[model samples]
Target: MTLADPAQITPLAKAPAQAAPGAKQRDVRLDFFRGIAMFIILFAHTPGNFFTSWIPARWGFSDATEIFVFCSGMASAIAFGRAYDTAGWRLGTARVSFRVWQVYWAHIGLFFAVATLLAAIDMTGAYDKVYIGTLNLWKFFVDPGPQLVGLLTLTYVPNYFDILPMYMVVLAMMPLIMALSRVHLGLVAVFIVGVWVFAQRRLLAEFGLADLHLGLPAEPWSDRKWFFNPFGWQLIFFSGFAFMRGWLPKPPVTPMLIGLALALVLINVPLSNIGVREFGFDWARDWRIANTIWITKSDFGLLRYVHFLALAYLCWVAAGDKGVRLLATGTGLLARIWQQALAIILKVGQQSLAVFIVSMFTARVSGFVMDNIGRDTWTVVGVNLAGMCVLVLTAYCAGWYKSQPWRKKVAQ
Candidate 1:
């Protein structure tokens, strides 16, 4: 059931890609939000970046993870949905399978490259700290045999390396959801919801019940699970997916709805992790500790899901129709500057997968640089700005490669 009146609750609006009369139009909103998330993720991952304290997570229950997963779902709808519609389910399945393979290698490559970098840094004896130890990868180096096998099988997932694995699992669920739509859209909804419910085993167990026993093992020996549990995270992922696929209805932007969403966001500020720790609110801390399960990141707890939706709704409304408000139209210098800035953001979002891989590696290096130097006010700003520049270059280079200038016809 919808929260709004039936009249106001209609299928979600499609972005106006307008390649042809009936073709899907590109949604600037998705790219804008995803671009913003890329910057936030960079800040959040950087070891001593005080900028992270100002990121969304510090003031709210949800963070860049929500934007990433949710946007991935919407992007998948655009990137993969057409193949399923034009080709049969079998071909669509093949297409998605290829993507999963690509992502699998990317994840593996990221781990090895980063690990090797950290190891090399440690071998130099330049810094006092063991670089590799920061990531808690000692077990992998100590017992490579078992850990290698587990890594290949996705059983040795470390917290820092869990996002992609979780993303892969969520991506794997798309074809099944698509096929379910053929039988009945309602069936697809039920199946998606059922999986999410199963993922909430942890939350359910907290209420004096049996555990749900879901999620992949995060270690070779222990019973630890992946930090980002795809099963539970898929709830939000599929929420964005379904919204793009017209499986769910978008509520009309009403003043009452906006107020409700805004209030929820405000309420979360005082209840957030930073709020409790920084403000020294004993009562808030007590409340948060007792109800930690509700906001737990691993399980994609109910409060986070609710809070994210509220935040997302506010963002959606603020961005305006088709996010046209984000475009700078005037011919003035300021408009030109804003337009260029917007282009960079959109490019970064379009190349999110590549930018993400680079960001992950660069964030570590940025921290290491600061470690060698210092994390002073100016130093912190300088290091983060340097990292952002790398990300920007990565986005531009990725975009250029994707364009394949080599394939262009020779000019006379």
Candidate 2:
């Protein structure tokens, strides 16, 4: 059921530097799972989508955030690691900086775009909910002077808008981590673990250890900090990066490992949100409350990390080596349908950054539509479906543009 020798796994680093024939093949497993996560993000972020309650978060300790961050780490390894390998350290860091710059502006642009939509919709005076107040962006709208600077400098990250800023900071940390990788991998491990521990200042504070938690200030005038802590989250991101960069060996799929992963996933269900609400697991609820920091989303809790890895390993096995299983569809009408669906999913995953931005934009629109039509069964279903269509369209559009179709000759 498994390869007994871990030595058979050739790391990306240990292997010869030359590119193998057809080495450009993208990992279908990564894109497919990321695409699934993208859909969950849309549902989770929608203001009043009751369907979101049924998502993985209700059934487990970890949710789509772990998937997104972890996949992003893998993606960065393929992208920036190549830059460092072929382009050398200086140019690679420059590439990282360029990406950071792009993401920075994207953060700024997304905030204003969402803000404008909220303002415009609110101005109509047609909706029951005050959109601005719903997100508590009135603070920014009422007095934009200092907060404008704070937003630009990433000092005033609102909770909903915090993910991009968190991503930007982690991307910025890549150069330092990459530099450490060159000196010695053990040094890199120590540095990563040390930063992760430092980020757990909130956990330390619970034990009365009086430490400063890791985060940027959420607002210039408030004690609140950024909802997502980059220092803590970078661990997952870099873990994926390390795996792809061959710093970590590929985990062999074994029957025992598979059984343990399934067990871990199932056990979490009893402690999950659905479990507490439906099964009336008061004890489980109490336990979670007692160990909030270990499961908290903000600090990238340990239980979540374990759960995600377990879940990830299972999915990895299911996807089959190199995700070849995902590509397989036997001869049937159902197979044909899966083939098309797979194409769409891969497209969405390939254009994640663009698709994610559009998904966020559409989530607000989805909420507005749901509010107007009311959240009946068919209406909710229709709204969700419509939002998904928009995301698919966004994906294809982004891909088309990225392909530089304009450069192709019209005719010979």
Candidate 3:
């Protein structure tokens, strides 16, 4: 079946009334998916957990990072886009700049926090070699001078700390992106795609432009490039932004398309499995080879892009007006439970920045626990459950803090 016309696409526009100027309406769908992504990310990041293997990454080319970044882009566009619409470009740009500052500091704070945690774990003799080697924390502490400089400059990032730096870069560019989007979304998309292609070919690396050293030593960390190259990842981010801005055509929900999407997901599951890796056909291997050009996670591969698109499409189809009504208004026990669960998730999602930061520390703590204690089934379950509870509590606290009358008074 054919898709609906782009011009006819509409937003849910179901956010509560704003008490202050420049406050954009909150979309529960964004919060719901973001919360889910946070949970998946926290689960997946905890090393040696059996549950990590069962995440969506095992079933598709994309993972929670894609969902997180895409949703973030949509959120940014909604927040800043509205600012620009009402308060003009100056305030919009200021808002973007302020957000960039916030994320930058958050990234710095997270790095130091994780480093301190690692240091504490090391002192306790619970330091896992895997974490140490992956994050290069040993090297970080050994030669703190240059590495610290690099970290401050966004030139050096350890594992688990890469996404925020990329996010900071993307936020820094939001003003330009918003400007181009206003002129024509097609122009913005083309520029983003061009940058992605350039990054994919390692053109920047070819020109010896991987990263800036800022007069620091190139030996340890100053010259190290970002793991999640912002250039390639920007395509996914901007695609989310564009879609949320109604720049892209929205397809009407149809049984045929939904069936096709489900079929694609089903087919991908086996193909993405370890079993398929063991018994790969020549055609499959060839397809894999072909897919490498544009599907690798390092460069935000094309297959990964397509997978997220399919997933987003599925979500769009499933979260229509009728579906939302059923979810919110149903009287059955399971329905009520789901509604309550979504409310909690929405709260977590609304405070995603704080929750995400807390999740990183929790993931590290959970990993440390698994490494020092045990990796048995029950142990894994207990550790994961504890980590999730902490995350939920963090979310609740953040939501409660934001809801306090003092906060409103302070804002006024």
Candidate 4:
């Protein structure tokens, strides 16, 4: 069931300040969900070995990324709304701009660092054969050609794994979207849909046009990348942002949400089986529809979108009641540890981009080691799970450290 928007649920008079300058309690639901998302993402990307192979279905959690992205949009809306409500548009714009810059710089720095490290490894002959990182500047400049043309046009061109560039574009558009949101959400939805259509064909390809390639790669066998095309994915993001504004109907917590959850799950099994056989589990494939849709990650196809929406409804149902919280509070040390781990996961999620980039680097290194060093599945799982735990702990500890009085004073 859909809960009313915070704006509708709690009147303006009761709305808390947007991240007030104090030890403010966070929205437990959001944090908890983010924590859950991180875990799913981690498991999804975990080494494709025996440990991960036991997974009931490889695609069961396929919509994890979509849900995370939607939530990220909603989270941004909450932050921006609070900032606008309190400090006005100027402050809100500045804050978002800063955050966008922070993400951009982090990505750029990550690219260069990785590139340099890979170059070093290549020179040193660290492995049987060294692999170069794909973050080469030559891809974007100097030897720039047809591939770079996509980047130049900002239409469906990005390094398959790099989302920072598209994210920057989203940030740039946020102001216009926020303004439009105030006037009419229907207009915003139509505008997003129109962009999605334009992305399908080569025409309307212009500098700064919304790219259908959401930083995922196009494969020879499968052209779609990670399926986060701005042309198509923007609808998901915009829908979540609009939801925060109370533009969509809130599903009731009673029968509607419960029923939807069950129905979607049931529909997904057969749909997924048919999709796998017909579409080869590729999200971007054209299953042929009344209206054309780009199903690739770059095109944000119907399959992934529907999967995401269905999973989101399920997650909402799971989150609607306090059962999970009660479970967390169970009388068991293991439960307590899991709860604490969840807290750490939330901290990592808050600083998600940084954590994600680092995790990617770690995963790459681990992959190399696994391939070259040895095939110790149990050891790999043990080590990797431990590493994940350490990463979460480090994130939370760093956040805790940042919150210390001396550090706060020094920043001031």
Lowest lDDT block of 10, candidate 2: 1-10
Q: Which stretches of candidate 2 lie over 4 Å from their true place?
A: 1-25, 410-412
TM-score of each: 0.92, 0.93, 0.84, 0.73
Models sorted by TM-score, best on top = 2, 1, 3, 4
Task: Flag the better candidate by TM-score, 2 or 3.
Answer: 2
TM-score of decoy 2: 0.93
Q: What is the per-residue lDDT of model 4 for residues 1-412, given as tens digits with 9 covering 90 to 100?
A: 0111122122244444432221122344555555556555555454444444433233432455565567666666666656655676778677678777766666656655655555666677756654563343344333445544454333433353455555565666677765665577677777777766665433234344436423444322235443344555666776665555455655666777677666766655533434555447555223323223323455556556666676667666675543355235665898888777666655666656555666655655555556665657676776578658755865565556545769768989
lDDT of 2 by residue, 192-293 (tens): 888877787658797776455676779888788788889898888888878877788889899999999999999999999999999999999999999887
lDDT of each: 0.81, 0.82, 0.71, 0.54
| Candidate with best lDDT | 2
**What is the total number of backbone clashes in candidate 3?**
1
- Which residue segments of model 1 deviate by more than 4 Å? 1-23, 207-211, 410-412
Candidate 2 accuracy as lDDT = 0.82
TM-score of 1: 0.92
